[model samples]
Target: MIGKTFSHYKILEKLGEGGMGVVYLAEDSKLERKVAIKFLPRHFATHSDEWERFKIEAKAAAALNHPNIATIHAIEEVNDEIFIVMEYIDGQELKEKISKGPITIEESIKIAIQITEGLNAAHEKDIVHRDIKSSNIMITEKGKVKIMDFGLAKIRGGVQLTKEQSALGTAAYMSPEQARGEPTDHGADIWAFG
Candidate 1:
């Protein structure tokens, strides 16, 4: 999609891809700012269930306004191509940092605190980010932590999105209850933090 114009945004380069969507770096000509746009994979876009989940992810994240959580600018569909425009985070994923080597205790503590703060904000809004693994966490170049991807988030007392008895998050980081496919709340996030 490089060089293609989706609305007023011109795609510059591909950022990354995951199970849920493919992210791209784009230039928002209207706002004159760099933004990251996540598009539902072509295959998934045709599936109503996946489309609903993608919309939910946008709604869940767009509702938050926190420094430690990536900001959602807008969710748009152009000619049936659905995508979400969000703040472009120029940094590496926490998973990449950890893969290089172990970080100092102090650095670890700082990251943990930021993640906790972000999670706190989400919980306060009754949003449970089911996927809280390292890859889902971005550490900006300036040492700011921003949580990304609320694809599996469950908004408490909201519509039921997932199938019963089916696990939704990363296996290694899931809380016992989450792994068991049981009902969860903010406690699941706290458990992942540990």
Candidate 2:
């Protein structure tokens, strides 16, 4: 369904592909707006757990209303494939922009503040952001920071999170306790904010 049109979203360009899924730039005909559509992996299509996680991600992310978090617009199944629609930012991802040079400390602090506010909002609602990283942070042309990819993050009572020596979050950013396989709370997100 990469080149296919689901409802009014005409697939325009392929933006990204990763272990989780593929992202495409799509046009929202009804609103005359552009949106990002993430398609789940084909292999995981019938996998109950992955499907549950994907649905959970769509529902959970859609519930978050903050200036610093990406807005989830809709989730629908087309031809047995799950796709999530989100605000299609027209600027560079933080990873792409960061390479030009490090952002100023003040700018960096502002980014942290934005993330903290977003995380705090989620945490206040008991939605912990387990995977907060530079790559997951998007920097729009207007200088706003929007966090992405809570696909791996889970609600407290949702799932076991992971299975093995490794933890849920990226190794470079995981809290010590989280890496040690301990249950993490909202403060764990603050610890990762650094």
Candidate 3:
């Protein structure tokens, strides 16, 4: 999809790819700004359940507005392809930072505070971020934190997405209850954060 225009976004180059979708750096023609476009893989897009979950991820995250959280500008479909337009963050993933070397206590505390605030915002909205790990958190050039990937989030009072005894998320970060395949709440995020 490189060099192609979807809606008003002109794809410049691919930024990265993950299990959920491929993200691209694009230019917004109408707004004259840069943005990231995450497109659902064609193979997975054909699956109704997965497609619905992708849409849900957009909806869940779009409802939240916080400086510590990545902003979802739009969820669009072009030629039957679904994609999400999000704020382009210029920084490294927290995972990379942690892997490079040990972070100072002060830096760690700063990051922890940002993460907690971000999580607090989500939890206050009754949205549980089931997947909370270093890889899903970004540290911007200005040292600001932005929590991303709401694909595995569970909206409180919404339909139960996972079956009973079905565990989801990175095994290493999974809470005891999550690892045990039990229902989890916001507390699961706390476990992962620790």
Pick the TM-score winner.
1
Q: Rank the candidates by lDDT, best first.
A: 1, 3, 2
Off by over 4 Å in 2: 159-166
Global lDDT of model 1: 0.92
Q: Candidate 3 — which pairs collide?
A: none
Q: Which ten residues in a row have the lowest lDDT in candidate 3?
A: 156-165
Candidate 1 regions exceeding 4 Å error are: none
TM-score for each model: 0.95, 0.90, 0.94
Candidate 3 local lDDT, 44-69, one digit each (tens): 78887778878888888999999999
lDDT of 1 at 185: 92
**Residue pairs whose backbone atoms clash in candidate 1:** none
lDDT (10s digit) by residue, model 1, range 85-193: 9999999999999999999999999999999999999999999998898998999888999999988988998877777898888888899999999988999888887
Which lDDT value does model 1 have at 162?
77
Worst 10 residues of 1 by lDDT: 159-168
**Model 1, backbone clash pairs (residues 3+ apart or across chains), number:** 0
What are the lDDT figures for the candidates, one per model? 0.92, 0.81, 0.90
